[model samples]
Target: MLERDSPTPLYEQVEALIKKNILNKTWPKGKKIPTEAELMKKFGVSRGTLKRAISNLQKNGYLVQRQGLGTFVQADIEIPLERGLYSFAEYFQAHHIDYSNKILSAKIPKKTSKVIADKLGITINDKYLCLRRLREVEGENIMLIENNINISSAPHIETADFSKESLFSIIERYSKETVEYSETKYSAVGANSEVSSYFSIKKGAPILYQEQLVHLSNNSIIEFARVWIKSNHFTLKTILHRK
Candidate 1:
């Protein structure tokens, strides 16, 4: 149900209509929405317009894409920042939120860059494993994480199956090191073409960027990471305690 003759753009009309349906419980939470073809025919809109509308609805936290599965209504997900050591998987598990991970790459580069070497306290010539993964919540791509880990600490890290395993857990089990704390820096950024493709969002959309250096109990830097989070669907919350 959309207004074609209204001055509002077709995509905006479609977005409003879909959002209304979601808010009114016409499309209940966790239920798959109509197919793109069906929506296009119903709205009498072009494919690009329909996709744009769906993307808008997704960015606003109303819908989720399940890769091969159809898009469905989204539920709330909250990640607490008060804890020093945070794990995305643990949070999802605790909240009982259905989630999945897609590993893009996990390999040891021939040459380590100065920036990565400096952060990990390794020589530029030393080898390190770089892992890139996308985290999906309720079938929606919500965050992209790029982790640079020292190979010397975890020799067989390159061969580890990250799809079903957590990187921090791997380090602890393989390297015999526990994550003590992390020095994190946060910033706001606009999604570039690469990031937009990963999140299926429009280029220049707002994103929350975080750079962190993870350390072991002995105070050795073991991992350096860059995380990009979808701004609309995720929020970073922290509680302050004064000693």
Candidate 2:
């Protein structure tokens, strides 16, 4: 029930109540909420007010609107994003979410983009392995990753099986070096045609983009990586400062 005389806006009150239902599981994930008319009737508010509240919830990750379908509760994944310059392989392990990786491509490229060359401190013609993978969890596509490894320094890496071995470990064993530090640039973007198909999302849907550089203990670059993260379900709790 809304307080007709209260100072807080009616729509804000409605948003809070809806969010509480989501958190408390009163409205379980994927369950569609009532229609605008029904919500207006239930809350004794105008259609405009109900719409405002619903829009607010959607923006804040509490709800998702599907075309031709009523709004539905969304499953939220709040994790430590941009951590240690690695990837979401840890997110699944930490949350106990069952996940699998599909190697899209793992091969040496004949040509390199200047951006990638600059990041790895190598020439455009340098020998490097490009690894592309699609990761899924609980039958939902989650991440697309591309790792550009400077295989020229670790020639034996060309024959290694990434499915059975960790890339970092392989690098260390072959090159006698380990990751000293890393830097990552993060941003939000719209899903491109290639990305939309992989995630089964509409074109231009929100996507999280990241570019990272892993450096060896000697300050030489190990790998330059790029990641495209499926937004909506994932929210970043970004508080970062390394001591």
Candidate 3:
């Protein structure tokens, strides 16, 4: 309902109502909404007004239009996991999608940096398994993840094949511990030389960089991870509720 004195246009009010349905999951991902005529009848608005509302939502990623077919609800642009709750695989599983990982680099590197030692809770000279992997969704390369694991904590690291098995699953199987939570920081940065080549994008292309520290229920750091994600492949959501 548009109020004449509210300063918002009728089309904009209609657009907001459609968006509310989307956010509330009334129109789930990949589902099609009413056609233009149907929406016009339902909202009691003009055809031009309904079209304008749909157009605005499409531009903002809430709806996707097909050339011959009517518009469908967009695939959820964001993973719904909270910042500290789940692993990447958990998030994927919740969305009913399969993800594959390609091992790019793996080595037992001597931990020499002070920062690395502090995070891993080990001596500067302790050993760590440094691993780099590229993750793909629906066969599209979308993220590059690099992780450092304390060798002492992960003693039987070579037994499992990462390509077929889940890294967190294997770690829990071997260590008899579960990751309870994690902390991460997100930022945007230009791809570096190696990252640029690995992602197959241009050198200066923007990427979403996520740095994570995964912790076990025992309060030990389980994984130190850094990731570079393709710019538009993913989105993050945070909810703010007023008390």
Candidate 4:
């Protein structure tokens, strides 16, 4: 039963119902879904709520809508796993897929900005490896990462191929560390010229910006990363368990 008093909105509830049906094979992929009117009657939801739910599902790659026709479940959208914190390497290894990356720039920057200083816990003048990389999955460039690693902590930075290599993996391999958890913040912002170029998007387009600081089990900082993702390329799905 849908919760009326819960904070989750009505349209989201409608979306969840439809998504559950799709996942359970009741509404198999490639089959055209019920029309808006049919769905409104079945779910007992307002037309606006039904439309919003459909739009959300479409944005998440679950449904495809055709002009002058109807919406249908997409054939290519595999059911996504439950969302949680996972390292870049862990994600690839889990799927048994290999990805290619482009090395943009790797250098020791002498003047660390205030933001970088706070993230790496270093002085403003401290030198660090300012690693810039473009990550691609299946020949599509989807993410751009600009990282600042403290030079003192990562002494072997020169040898690491941050392009095809995961920074977290390299850090653990070279420094013997394990990233237990990280503090991350997400927000939407307009993309700048440099950031938009990597994804072939126009400047000022909305992008998802994630600032993360990963820590190891020993309480040492492992890596600090600022990832800029094309808003359309990925969908973030999470499960919130109630106590």
Model 4 residue-pair collision total: 0
lDDT against the true structure, per candidate, is 0.85, 0.80, 0.77, 0.75
Candidate 1: list runs displaced more than 4 Å: 1-14, 17-56, 65-73, 241-243
Winner by lDDT: 1
lDDT of 1 by residue, 45-155 (tens): 899999999988877788988879888887546567786576777777767777788999888888899999999999999999999999887656888999999879877
In terms of lDDT, the poorest run of 10 residues in model 2 is 81-90
On TM-score, the candidate that comes out on top is 1
Model 3: what TM-score? 0.66
Q: For candidate 3, lDDT tens digit of each residue in 2-29?
A: 5646788889989999999888989888
| Residue runs of model 4 more than 4 Å from their true location after superposition | 1-84
Pairs with steric clashes in candidate 4: none
In candidate 3 the C-alpha lDDT for residue 14 amounts to: 91
* Candidate 2 Cα misplacement greater than 4 A, ranges: 1-75, 81-86, 164-166, 240-243
